[model samples]
Target: MSAFNLETCARSNILALEPYRCARDDYKDDGTNILLDANENAYGPSLTTAAASSASSATTSSGPEIDFLGLHRYPDPHQRGLKRLLCNLRNTHHHTDKKITPDNLFVGVGSDEAIDSLMRCFCVPGRDRILVCPPTYGMYSVSAQVNDVGLVKIPLLPAPSFALDVANIKQALSNEPNIKLAYLCSPGNPTGAPLAKEDIRQLLEHPTWNGVVIVDEAYIDFSPEGSSLAEWVAEWPNLAIMQTSSKGFGMAGIRLGSLFASAPIARLLNSMKSPYNITSPTSALAMYAFSPDGLAVMHANREKIVAQRERLIRELPKIKGIGRLRGGIESNFLLYELLNKVGQPDNVTALAVYERLAENRGVVVRFRGKEHGCLGCLRITVGTETEVTRFLESVGETLAEVNGHDIVVYSDEEKREVEANAVIS
Candidate 1:
């Protein structure tokens, strides 16, 4: 089968439209001059940070009374320094100590912005279409629809696991000639299932899906194997890996997201993105977070979260309704089923329990009901051990209360049946 060419499947507006360019910065090089082009503070790293870095632990001051600097100027739009640090960090652990180049790195307001940029760059509103797996992140769909692009849905195979259907995706791509982009959420949001590495590699290798595959690896940090695609950005031009600092970094408030792709694609995405989208303070904070110490701390936290998640999965089943807790191969979130009337577990009916937990216990967990192929299940984020313990305690109380209510309702129905029989007699 012939693949869709630019002339065949390109969005009309995008093909015809002239590229938009923002005003050029006078100071664009990676240098240390007055540093005024992007309005960054001429000041360097914070004095407190310098002091802390150099001082011994015993001599360093504690608490929040630390002196900081460089709050008054605009941050680097390119985020070159931070990217260099991150590249080295990613290389040391994930790669063979080869730095991730600036061309392959793009830091945006958040992963949300990277998604939006991808949509804008590829989807020709009213012309081209995007393909997504069901029960995945909603942002892929939302961003496509917002851009006036059409969407094609290919749902995952159901439990005891929610695995990707590579055949179905291939079929969909062939069936629909208009698809310009394919969005995948690994360690999926609601399902917490990671797409199989082979499946991802297959999608990349397949001629039909070779255009653009946005792997939303937002929670990849918590996944068991870590990220496999970020290092392959240079090898695959059509590949754009979307990641966020919010999750493992515990800096969601900073709103820093990154896109890894070829330099040309990176430049195109940058063109599509809003100038000054990320604030100075945010860029500063993100740079700080990317520091070796900051990242090491995040890695420790991720390890802690993974441990806590395992504990939840093991301990949750002591409750009657929560028969057995299961999870995807990679992500930290867990989705467990409730015991149905036959004492057999029913995976599709946990929404009621989810609501009950939220209402009665003031606990909030994702209820994947009719929407995301989460038949009957509750999606709980992995929290700290203390938090998870508290959450499980609430789960126990909430389940008992729910079971009691169900028994009462069942009894009332039986009583009504008896009353009807008496009237008939």
Candidate 2:
């Protein structure tokens, strides 16, 4: 049991905010014919069968046909059905004894919305701050800036592991009472390393700090089983776990993200959010994604992604100018450095290759060279087998062209030796 008080931590204004009410609040639109409460285009959505077909196939789910006509009316602001389905999915997949309920969940446009909402709900603009572990997600910082919340920086413990500095984080929390939120990205964005549960527990159980500890498990599905701290939310009132259908479920287009927290925290977020934050179409698509067939498909696709990730790990270091693979293999992406002539990580070569891959080779990858501890690094998302093959060939060619020399292929033993001695720059 935690002694954290929501009213004490949340902004005074937010605590007193009277949420906006809409027509749906007064009258429920239970798919009745005489639905004239909310002013909507009664004629129905101007979408062709082709469009509906495209949408249905988007998630590869064979669920019920979408109600195109329902586009005229307002969507369920509460998203009760969606939340219930999500709860079931997590309860089964994560195999937790303490079952999750709708009251413990809040669905937003994306993880970005939940991130921004948490900042708005708890931290007062310009007065309060949120702590972030960099080489993690950029949105935490971006959302803080957008919300006018100050930031307390604590970069992850170097490369390879990219573990959280629990000691420094605790020290910062004790030093800064104004820090209302601490954002920890598990299987981090560019780092791809999951923060240890014990380190997170240290902050959660800190005797002094009462602020919320938000663990962003955006890529948890890609990591080993039982890695999520979602189950702990039941016990820790000051803890919130953010997950998404975007990554593993392949439903990014639906823009569905979930925040699992104490019932009080979840209710606060729901009260402050816009009435129809989620569109009808988005909800329809997401429902399909939560269906039994959808879950199977998602798991199958995840297996494919994991397989490709392993392939990249085994093969990427063999490339001539590519340095050692940085970060843990816990996400769909891989971060590796581009080496200069003397086998040193070089940002110049990384940027050049990034541009060439998109422009000349038609293979796009993100250049994360500017991020801390990620100099000369390119973040490559695992793609289809064919796509991976093309990328390997194209990147090798691009490196050779940039270096103005033929690529030096290495044997298994030589590759190991080179990787072992490669300098992290």
Reference-based lDDT, each prediction: 0.68, 0.85
Tell me how far candidate 1 lies from the true structure as C-alpha RMSD in angstroms. Answer: 8.9
What TM-score should be assigned to candidate 2?
0.91
lDDT per residue for candidate 2 within 241-309, as digits (tens), equals 999989988889889999999998998899999989999888878988888988889889999998888
For all predicted structures, in order, the TM-scores are 0.79, 0.91
Clash count, candidate 2: 0
* Model 1, position 53: C-alpha lDDT score: 43
- In model 2, what are the clashing residue pairs, if there are any? none
